[model samples]
Target chain A: MTLQMTVSPDFPPAYIAGWYIFNTWLQRQSGLPIHLTLYDSFAAQRAVLAQGGIDLIYANPYDAAFLVRECGFVTLAAPCNRADEVVLAGTQTGPVNTIEDLAAGTVIARTDDPDVNLMGMMLLEPAALHAGNTTAITVDSYPLVAKQLLQGHAGIGFFLEEAFDSLSALVRGQLRELVRSRISVIRHVLLAGPGVRAQQVEHLTTLLLAMDQDDRGQAVLESMNLSGWEAHSQEDTEFMIDLMDTLDTQVLPG
Target chain B: MDGYQTRIRYFDGHSRDALIREHEVPFPDGRLIVSRTDTCGIITHCNQAFVEMSGYPERELIGQPHSILRHPDMPRAAFQDLWETVQAGRKWHGHVKNLRKDGSCYWVLATVIPNVRHGRIAGYTSVRRKPARSRIHESIALYARLREAENP
Candidate 1:
């Protein structure tokens, strides 16, 4: 069967072509037939996943836990030194300067990115804001989240730290960072499903680890805004998953 | 005939109104009505029990928003809590009143969980089973108050 590969939908949209290039390179190196599918939303991607249509995936931290625990997927690699973090921001001209300044009824613009939204909500706990007390407006992408804040449609916004940093300087300048999660252990991971043979997983892991040393691999990495790939041990994966579960339980309903 | 026509209105392409039979479809014991939806609440899959309980064929349920089965009497805040809990990757349990295609309704104790793929939430799976009639009565009264508060 032709192996199906997909990346988490939360990746920066500009790097979409980069993922395709990477997929092509992997197929060539492994001498295996691989098809790359891009999904517009988490729900759309998940529809296919429910049917067991995916074999290889670049997953976000939240999904990683599920794939590991429920789907029996094994970690292949993770982006080197790239931890997923969330930034809570507001318009520079907005009255809320800190989390403490936020109050009930604050309109929060965000994407469906689960982990980022979870962290953003946690940051607001200090000020007693939550899903019940505050209103949440979901947008399609991080840029749209910024647009909502800039247009005064929302009082604050939740963003993936990488997405926040990649915003154009003009837009970035108008936004003031209220806070950012400092959790460094959580990061996106590449995983191979249970159907992938052990030999194939080992071969792919080796190829990924060597990508930074070659010119073509370096170019692909640069396109994807990745420094390199590092092997993620099962223990490390379990630890992160546990941390995520712990965090999930700590969030109390408003 | 004119008065009867006035009692019928449309909902989800089916005519429903105050005069539509208000009755219960008692959930089958020892069976679960299972359905899956994408993160956006679009139904992706449903089991035979769900189809039977909902009075909707598999074709009608799939690809439709889960809200297609939402009874008008169900309070909005209850769903809000469900969404908030599942979006955070947590499980939620509650009693829900679900409308069937024929305009009848059923009560179930429902549990919903977010399905994760590659470290991100992809969809949700909801498994519902028979709820005690006493518990259903409690929900009925509680939801009535909640609906009143919401509308007021």
Candidate 2:
């Protein structure tokens, strides 16, 4: 059977293209008929997950928790990058230095996508008044969040630390990190759907975890900005559970 | 693009709990660490006490995931039970040890209530008070046992 492997459109189009290449290599090595799929938007991905269309998924912590809670998906392994984090950034001269500095008058800018926005929300919630004064202006991309900050259209910007670093040096020099959501091991995971067989799941998990030991797999991991995959542990599940609770509770009673 | 902005407002209350210290800080009497989260546990509103007790500035805590204060020593089972109880629309109360920015710890007696809106659970309200020292001690031992169970 051709197993459907889906991915969240977390990265730019170019990196996603690399994911397809990695998928082809993995398919060959595993001898499993795996077809890679990517969604343009989280809404599209949600629809796919809801219908149980995908056999495997590469998903972030928040989405992983959501899928496990609502869709019976199980994480098989988590992929790690050298430095995994999400941060809130602002121009060095911007009046806001702390989360409290983002009071009513301050404007917050972030991407409209849920995958990123959810992290923004998680990081921002403790600072966001269960009820209070802060406005979140959603743009289409991380670059736009930076643009909004640079142009003085927004007081605060939310982005992945790497994405912010990818900006020009001059732009990079202009920004200061206000606070970071430093989940030490923040990374995406390979998850199995409700329909996958346990033996196959175990086999796939072992193959991916040992990928870094081989040459072809090392190349794929390098292209994807990953060190390697590790077996899922109970701590991983606890982290997600806490994450889900955090996301659920951000909105206070009106 | 022409600039467009939206405004959010918060009520003000000034209160400071115990400061972060190297030793375990007991929750101050009458000082409560309270916060509300959407059904998923993302903090929305927190009283000044919650921010102060966490040893994190108020602004940093507002839009953060509640797990931002998760102490590594905390067992997953405690939270799993909390979620199961609250998700079922029941009030759940327990003792919790949370980590502060400086790595110090504090214990709180937390009661989580499902906030209902229009006959459905809108979110949750977590009100935490100073837990009794005896309860804190019991929790410490129990949590240690739970962690041992997990590792074993």
Candidate 3:
């Protein structure tokens, strides 16, 4: 049977082709027939995941809890020096210069990426913008959230820090960031499902860790906008997953 | 062409005055319809599946703004969300009601992503597939409420 692989939908679209390239490289290196399937949404990806259809995944920290605890998946690796962060921003010309200036009727534009949304909401706490006070509109991507700010349709927006930084300089110039979450421990991870053999996991991990040392591997990493991969021990994985669970519970009721 | 022209008003970049038929064409499962548009949302390429589902020939689609297929029933907020998402260099997924050349409509689960070239977004690519019946129903109700809010 062919092994299946998927990446979290939160990754930038520019890396779509890069993921496919990495998949082909992995298949050749591991000698496993890995089929890469891309999903457009976390909900859609999780639907297949609930049925045990995915054997390998590059997932965000929020989903790591479900994958590791409920699905019997093991942490394989994480990108080096990359941590998930959230940025709360508004149009440079908007009245809200800071989070404290956010008002009751403020329209907060955000995406369905749970962790980023949660952190963004927490950042809004100082302004007393609760579920009852603010209007939240869910868009499909970070760029859309920024669009809401740019068009004066929304008073504020939530974005993944990486996504915000990736915005074109021209667009970024039009917005001012209110705050950014520095929860450096929460990072995306690569994992192997229960179906993956231990030997295969070890070999795959070895190849990934050495990716930055070779020229071709380095090029693939650059395409994905990654520096390199670092081996994630089970203990560190559990710690990060536990932190995500705690953060989930701490978010204000919406 | 007369039937199509009579039913839907062709505009340069906006189609807020298009007619709605209250009809929905069910998108076929396992078939993916694909199209590409320039940064300004003008059609650059469309696949055979897109042509069939849209009821427009390739010649008719090329050089037209993507809004040409915009159905009247689709809320402005939905398109705003789609535009914002793709403009940010990210992928956006949503259920869309599209108007065909014959003035009929179809519902598709659409995924649109920016086509980045040389560190800049040159255009966008939208790949659409069959939407779940349940999602279509939810979208209908949700879009109705959103449209009401917009006009109210």
Candidate 4:
């Protein structure tokens, strides 16, 4: 009967705007009872969702993977409203052309949000991702790092797309994209549980997808880039579950 | 009329409530603090006892999380284990260090239970009592170092 949604702190304001529009659409359209709760990280949200305390959750692919498979959650669909990734250069240096092109001890300032997209990028070159090394500075927000970089604190910076969009104009202008990532499918997924029936679940999805095509839904879709909802498969949900299982096992040095 | 009283915060509001609201378990020094959290460790409430024990006024505790009381003396495994057990709808009993309003500290022997609804967790509930000397000594020694590291 309740809908619990969890989203990242990165680009949260944008999604808040998107929700006001989208939730209003739902209020007018099918009268489906839906609500949202936002968070700063995927790990924190995933833990709460796993307790089976929530009815539905809006999670990233990485977190969703674990919730649907390892926990008792089931994925309904994935959304493509906000998606972009970029490697931002510091003011004193140019962006690296590739992960391999960076100097062995190249300094890269990072902002680590609570999701895997950025962490996944770091995994692409883990050795290059030490947190405390003089060459690597990990912060919680991109603009902070961008500010530090612009002030000549760090040599270079990496900004995932959402953060890249909101950086100060000064930081944005001073920095150039060293490289851009392929548009990754970062979805805001809706996952459900055993209490929800198939018919009720489909009704919610159909109403949501059809909303965009309608005049009211169209407005929300435009603002949020919420194209439509498609059925999610077990495959789409497995990767995160496997990763969480790995993280869980490796949590302590037992 | 101005006799000294054990001050506590109401879970739902800012007004101070008396510790007369009896709990299933009686705490030493009448210092019983109760909290609610969904199985994930998010806090839902902190009774008047919690405010008195924490030295934080109700305004500071309302809508804040339960782990807001997390003391460094506690091992990471304890929290990890607490999450695992409560999410499984089990109750946990242990010792804890609670930070006071002015950044001083106190100790507690605590029990935490999951709020189960329809065979699932709705939230978690916790009860605390004054910690024994043995528990306090170990935790305080551990926390002294933690606070030092955090401050230094």
Candidate 5:
């Protein structure tokens, strides 16, 4: 049986292509039939998950927690990006040295992602740096935001650590990290639908956990900006669940 | 790295003369007490805020379980819930009361997340911030009830 998997389109188009290619490799290696879908919007993805049209999913921490809480999806393994926080990057010699430094300058970011975007704003808003203001430029993706910052079009750029990690070494070398948020529960989460078999889940989890040890697997991971896959733990899942609950109850808008 | 050190410096020597007290120490705004632990919960690294607020020296805290700061008044179920929540690969947040070396107590709003590396949980991190007074009061009442339930 083919496992229907979906990835949210909140990522840049290239990363979506990377995920497709990664899943295609999984199909070849695991000897299991697999079909991958990339939803254009989170709502479309949620609709498919609600209808049980998807059996496996790769999603950000917040959406994964939501699915596990609301749709009975099982937390499997997650790609380890080695960063659990949002990051602010700028040229090493630039005047933007702190969150407050961006108060009057253009801060380029991808505000489309509620997860990272909310995190970025949470750090900046208290300092009176509003994203809605002209000081904040909403870029569409990580690479583009990095480009904007590197090209000196903006004084600073806000994105997740993985996004910064994905940049070419030359770009990273030229930029300085001004801020990094506190760690979140997990990065992206891999989850299974109720209909998936136990053995299948176990096997896939094992395959992913070991994916980085091989050269070909490492190449796939690089394209998607991941270090490796790690086993999902019960405690980590519960932590994300609690975090989501707290975020929901908070008066702050993400 | 730069901001981390700057924040750490703020809390480094603040508790030098702390004395035992029934009252809670007022937490400064915008600073977070941060600690990182191995999967087994052994402290690996911590910030200055953690060192000061926990009432333990950096040396003493380095290899100890975070429970080193667990207050006697805290309910076991609360920690159990925290452990259960985070072990499930989710972020956990709640009010926590902790003890210091001088037998003093303090309250915080804590958020904990796992550090996943090489496809396994390498460690966990807890970031504690100043909590609202009313929230602490509510937690105090709830914790008291939970403690009574545990003993009864």
Candidate 6:
């Protein structure tokens, strides 16, 4: 079966390269071929997966929810995510470290798609002041969010940790850490199409988990930031149902 | 377009195909594509992946100008600068935006080098692959913006 699927283009070559290495390891272990069709964003991937273009996917945590519920896919494995997710904020003076320090009516900046970004924040629990308090400004890109922050147009920028280092470092220094989300990222996830043989996925994921125990396997795992795999699909059922309940999207013309 | 007749080799004067097969990029996942030609533009050889990604039957590309895939939106100055750099026999690495046969665009992290061997200038060789998302987003958007400005 074609393992082709969509993935977030956020991380770049490192993210794609990691998949290449993992795919190679899996093939050597299971003797099966896997291919991927990567897209620029989770939103883009989700649209295609919904139409049945992908048999497997490498998705983020919140994105994984959409695929599970909306597309009827099953999650097989979660890769190691970065320790930090990301925060969006503009210039701030003095020490405003806690989430409580921020006042109401503060506008937290975000992208056009709230399904991934906002849902992730909900999972992480932003400052209560953020509830019914903050207004969201629709921006097209992260750089625009950065622009809003630099121009003092936005109060906070909620984004991924992989922001351009210059602005990322500045935010870390200048803004209050209103919400330091643990970024329960699914640095990588192994997924399968709806109604895929459970045993096939189970067998491959079992090989992925076993890689942590041996030496050569550890080399590939370490180079790839594999912290070992965990099984959690049944647990994801409710979130999946909830995700489809809320998010509506269209496929991007490729 | 007997660009191949104008032979020059930048490194060790080998044909483009030979260099590609042997040049193990230091980055294990890194890939390269090279070809030989004269000081003028003409294609002699191409690496395996080059043919695959360009989506062109190999024969269609070998005798054509490298600019065949130059999207109408690419900056002429980028090409001009690239030519200038390779002519100086210095290697340059940067991101490039190219169009596929079907007109879909993909960004490549590209490196271009001039062929210089035995005190004579030969042709040029380029290596490229899909770039990181951050770089792809920044580079493609910026290049297109620059191209529009140049045309305007």
lDDT of 5 by residue, B16-101 (tens): 22234475676653355777788878999887878877768899999987776776667778878888877888777778888776
Candidate 1 lDDT over B118-139, as tens digits, reads 6888788786755555567778
Residues B6-115, candidate 2, lDDT per residue (tens digit)?
Answer: 22111121222322334676565324466778886788877677777788887888777677676656777788788889999887777788877666778776778777
Q: For model 2, what is the alpha-carbon lDDT of residue A164? A: 71
**Residue A148 C-alpha lDDT in model 5:** 81
- What docking grade applies to model 6? incorrect
> DockQ winner among the candidates?
5
Question: For candidate 3, lDDT tens digit of each residue in A1-254?
Answer: 79999999999998999999999888887899999999999999999999999999999788887888778899889999998888889988888776777777999899989778766765665554667778999999888988988998899999999899989898899999887765566799999999999999898999999989989899989889999999889767865654444333222321
Lowest lDDT 10-mer window, candidate 1 chain A? A245-254
Task: Candidate 5: give the TM-score of chain A.
Answer: 0.72
Score each candidate by Cα lDDT: 0.81, 0.69, 0.80, 0.55, 0.70, 0.55
Give DockQ for candidates 1 onward, in order: 0.01, 0.04, 0.01, 0.01, 0.08, 0.01
Q: In terms of docking quality, how is candidate 4 classified?
A: incorrect
Q: Report how far off residue B42 is in candidate 6 (Å).
A: 78
Report the TM-score for the A-chain of model 3.
Answer: 0.94
Reference contacts recovered by each candidate, as fractions? 0.00, 0.00, 0.00, 0.00, 0.00, 0.00
Tens digits of per-residue lDDT for model 4, B1-152: 22223433322333332322211122233234566665556665666777766767878776776766654344445666777776776666666665454444566666676654445666666766444354456655765775565446
lDDT of 6 by residue, A103-166 (tens): 5576666664443364333422223333455677767666667667666776666665555343
Candidate 3: which pairs clash?
A: A144-B84, A144-B85
Please report how far candidate 2 places residue B15 from its true position, in Å.
27
Worst 10 residues of 2 chain B by lDDT: B6-15
lDDT tens digits, residue span A136-206, model 5: 66766777887787777887777777567778898888888877765445467788887888888888888
Q: If you score just chain A, what TM-score does every candidate get?
A: 0.96, 0.87, 0.94, 0.73, 0.72, 0.70
